[model samples]
Target chain A: MSNNNYVKNLIESGMRIDNRKFDEFREIEIKTNIIDRAEGSSIIKIGNTQIIVGVKLSVGEPFPDTPDEGILIVNAEFSPAASPSFEAGPPDENAIELARVVDRAIRESHCIDLKKLCIVPKEKVWNINIDIQVIDFDGNLIDAACMGTVAALKTTKIPKYENDEVDYEHREGELPLVDLPIYVTIYKIGDKLFVDPTKEEEEAADARISIATIQDGKICAIQKGGTGYFTISEIERAIEMSIIIGENLRNLFKH
Target chain B: MKEKEKLIINRKRLDGRDLYEMRKIEIQINPIKNSMGSAMFKFGKTWAIAATHGPRAAYPKWQQNPEFSILKTRYMMLPFSTWERSKPGISRRSIEISKVVNDALSNVIFLEDYPKTMIDVFIDIIEADASTRCAALNAASIALALAGVPLKDIVSSCSVGKIDGEIVLDIAGFEDNYGEVDCAVAMIPHEEKVLLLQMDGIVTKEEFKKMIMLAKEGCLKVYESQKTAIKQAFTNIIDIE
Candidate 1:
């Protein structure tokens, strides 16, 4: 309790243990096309938090609700080596939440233009599977995972499909993208809110909100987590912070 | 599927509601006699029942925490609840919804009061149309409150969607099938704080804010019905005495 109070007091007094500004994110480094065997892959590191995302394409049937659109499935795994809290088994709620949030951002934004992936409408559409792995333990996994997923998708190329057969030896054109979505998460410890929290800071935080925005400051997805609440003004501030940070992060992909 | 029928015509939904209107809601308390607390909440065509059990001993000893109690929420949709038969059993979708609903209520309940204990809330979707999660949350919150669990406030929930370039409240039926976006919100009304928020689909930032405002108003209305149901339940008990 005292440790929690100590962290909260410091944050409320306009200071972070890491000396970062309230809205500042840790140094981000995103590397794409990290795996040659995979169709697309990326490794992203925000401070000590590292995540890798790889995209795999397969032929499958589309869901009934979206018969004309291709299928997109996101799966995430937290390696036991990443953190002591994570176990070596199937995904728990945290892992599921991480994957779902990233999936919502990508799927909701219509970034992939799923229509183009459709080979035969409901019969034989290209199913895009994004697998995210947590390689290091830190905080701000959501932001890092989202960035890595986008990076991987940006570098993705469709596998050659001819005569109802996928040819691994051949390559097709680049993956069509409609818009780029970037996620920015803000953690609230006390009255103060900050971005890109470390593990220690995350432990002391009361609540956190993540917003995923597209190029024109449009919000595609949102999630509020933790056992604390945020007042109306706090939420508003978080949204503004998200938009500014998202724009800056989105700019990295232009190159 | 039928010639791309319009969802909204003449500024009104097919169900005869305005853009900012929600479905008629109904609440019933203690629907399950043997449970600690239980309630059924209905939003037009959608219905859900939630039951709360235990601040009793924690199970699986390792899962117990020494400092505070734990809250677990399980959300399920019956096979017959939807238009088509959904496979019976816990799916990934249910697991994710359970986690979010648990988070939405964990803050309100004073779990620290009962160390080494756990509270389990189970919600079953009895019928479906749209906004099922929102309905499930509304039922679960009332069940927790009725169970005599110490709480800061009751959580109310609703969903907002955009259809044909217009934002509408409490999507159902045709609007839900063709809506461009669906955003579900759960909040503490008096505190003006949101507890659970999940959204999918596309909307600009301005439209998003408008949806939040509309959701808050919708939740407030749900809160009124909840309060009334609780009062009626207590009154019935007094008459039984």
Candidate 2:
């Protein structure tokens, strides 16, 4: 449509409504322990987008195959208050995609030492439940959620086990967090790339790629979304942008 | 009885309130400006919001009833609403609560007026400790009013329970979890008629009678606040205009 062409033309002219460069992120803010009941929690805001991540630790049996390691469950829910488009029922595909992408980044990057989370081997293990609640929606929900989850896990304090029983209210020690992995997403719009696209820009984008980089600057997870292709040179350029952007994001957490 | 010390101690509830004390209740009308009518209701730490839309049209035409408009209600809780990160979906508990709330609200609403149309009640818990369904029903009633729906009288809900061998008004999350015999009651004001009642755990018949009486007394207070919230909403509309 003519509207799409107008947006594309604006992007091609190196102009953004927000008056920022193509590879720039929105102003981000992060805070921890806003939720009173949860042991570990963080709230992240990227531009107008807001996400709160709460980490709950429970004692339960480990999986049969991975008996020695603890379990990590990540779930995301798009609250109806965040946007009019999101319904009040169960989480839909967008929520699921956000959860899976962030989960994959944390799980595959060897970020949290799951083995260290075990209590009595197979008999007892700590079950970590990381829940992402979309408080407000503007754009770039996945990146904000990922930051919140990581910051929350970093601040997580494991419950004390006394006499082989776990106490839910009492906190004992910090979680075994090994490496910090940062999530960076880049969108291709009208033969150009942009970082942290706003909601309107995202709707205009042809395709987007997300990369997760760990402490050592190595790519850990990669996901490509939307129905657009990228050339080899573009992919390399995106990777370079991710590395630099990821390092800045990594410094937000306590080293 | 799962954990006595966690709920009651020396005849006092965990939050250090008397047996008949209710958690702090707050009701703010029309929080979701995009919806026709909306309200955010809270009891102690638990919070839920209700947004009502439609009275527009019924989809597909087959499900429409000629005699009355339909009310489609969904009671949902956020994943971070609970301390232990509740699952992100409509659980059996939520489904049952939706039905119970819908039934309670249906009793007072003038549904027959909006023929071939439907109104949606979307109640989402932003936080949770206990008695979310009751709060949801209370908020939904206010939401319907904001939607300008016809009603006999606005409904209000509260929960009364027997804890430490004593009947109490408005049991909180920990009390409901560890206490015995939680009875959720929804009532129409002034007439003092019961609209919905569900008993969890067990109570003797004599104790049940006392609990209902206690719940009615609590419901009257809830009804007062519901009226106050609606008035405040009206005041806000005037201020906006």
Instruction: Find the candidate with the highest lDDT and give its number.
Output: 1
lDDT (Cα, tens digit) per residue for candidate 2, span B62-113: 9798988998889999999987888999875576567667767776778899
TM-score of chain B, per candidate? 0.95, 0.93
Clashes of 1: 0
> Quality of candidate 1's docking, in CAPRI categories?
medium
* Model 1 Cα lDDT, one tens digit per residue, B1-241: 3467788899998889999988888787898987899989989889999999989889988889998999989999999998889999888888889988899999889999989999999999989898999999999988998999999889999999899889999989667778888888899976789888888877887888888888889989988888788778754321110
**Interface DockQ of each model:** 0.78, 0.01
Q: Give TM-score values for chain A, per-prediction.
A: 0.97, 0.96
Give TM per candidate. Answer: 0.96, 0.52
TM-score for predicted model 2 compared with the true structure: 0.52
Best TM-score goes to which candidate? Answer: 1
The true-structure Cα RMSD of candidate 2 reads 20.7
Model 1 regions lying over 4 Å from their true place: A1-3, B1-3, B234-241
